[model samples]
Target: MSAETDLIKLYSQRILALAADIPHLGHLDAPDGSARKRAPLCGSTVTVDLIIADGRISDFAQDVKACALGQAAAAVVGANIIGCTRDQVQTARDQLAAMLKQGGPDPHAPFDGLQVLGPARDYKNRHASILLSLEATLDAFDAATATSASSA
Candidate 1:
């Protein structure tokens, strides 16, 4: 198959629709943690802002400047982030990374949305773009987790 075919597969209808309808597309007014990440190869960027309450994501927002794949990933996170914990998000990030980098299994439930981007693994150049959302989310998690850990 041509490389373009793989690219097309990476941007399926679900991905396109998710990209078109990105949720939580804004900055939070009072976030417990926030982070921004950029994909150098594609020039895509994502900034994540969030608040934690009782160890779960209580509020979330994002400013995403990305292609379909990255936007889709952000959409997935935005769609299911409420009530999620740092460990859940981090595990999903690790699973997604393994899926793209080592041909590992898809992430567990909920995060399985990342399965749609599986085809992009062959295009190493796009890896950063596809991972931007998760990376930014994880970075945001770092701040929330640190303070929560000390205070909890």
Candidate 2:
């Protein structure tokens, strides 16, 4: 098969995997606040709700709809950020973006679960779908933090 075909197949597989794991998809119910994000080009939207306690993420969930890439990306983000602090979430976001932009990184580190998206890097059009969840998650975290700060 051709490289394009291979990439498509990879994306398809990831999407299928996410679909099979339906319970993993959706948003956290954060008592603090919630945030939503979308990729206008692809119509992929993810809304994240999170609960923050003592400056750490106490609970998390998300509601997402879009292509396979977006769904899978959201699942990965939700799974990774559950117990993280705001700083840790920010760091993961930065590191994930950098890894996506600079090709693959050490698979054993911050980019572990996210590395599955490496094949997506070559497909410029799908990049937004892949990153949509991460962006949405960060936005949700920011909103949660802002709300917490104001309430304090």
Candidate 3:
């Protein structure tokens, strides 16, 4: 089968449905931190806003624009990030990058849902888009943590 066909298969109905049902898909008023990431490869963009409480993600939101891969990734992140810590998000991001670029194992625990995107590895152009949500989210977390630490 052609790469296009494989790409289509990679984005199964389950993924598409997840994309359509993304949680926290909007802006947050007076968020603790916010960040945006744009994939140069596919013009995919994801902006994240979040609030942290007791070093945990207390609330989160995102605005995403991209193909199904990006949407699905944002869905996974949004769905599971409610109580996540900066370490968890960073770890998930690192594991995802390894999985996509170096054939590493899937992400662990709360982010194991990202395993659904494993097939995306075969499509190099989609990697950045798939990682956009987590990238932006991690950035937001970093900013929030730094601000809190400095103020304390």
* Index of the highest-lDDT prediction: 3
Q: Name the runs in model 3 displaced over 4 angstroms.
A: none
Q: Which candidate model has the greater lDDT, 1 or 2?
A: 1
lDDT of 2 by residue, 43-116 (tens): 87777777877777777777778677767766676666767777776666676666667774633444267777
Residue-level lDDT tens digits of model 1 in 33-96? 8999999888999999999888888999999999888888888888888888878988998998
lDDT of each: 0.87, 0.69, 0.92
Question: Per-residue alpha-carbon lDDT of model 3 for 27-136, expressed as tens digits?
Answer: 99999999999999789999999999988999999999979989998999998999998889999999999999999999998989888898888889999999999999
Q: Candidate 3's C-alpha lDDT?
A: 0.92
Candidate 1, superposed: residue stretches over 4 Å from native: 146-152
Q: What lDDT is reached at residue 48 by model 2?
A: 74
Candidates, ranked, lDDT: 3, 1, 2
- In model 3, which residue pairs have backbone atoms overlapping below 3 Å? none
Candidate of highest TM-score: 3
Off by over 4 Å in 2: 1-4, 12-15, 22-24, 27-30, 104-111
**Where's the lowest-lDDT run of ten residues in candidate 3?**
2-11
- Candidate 3 displacement at residue 59 in angstroms: 0.5
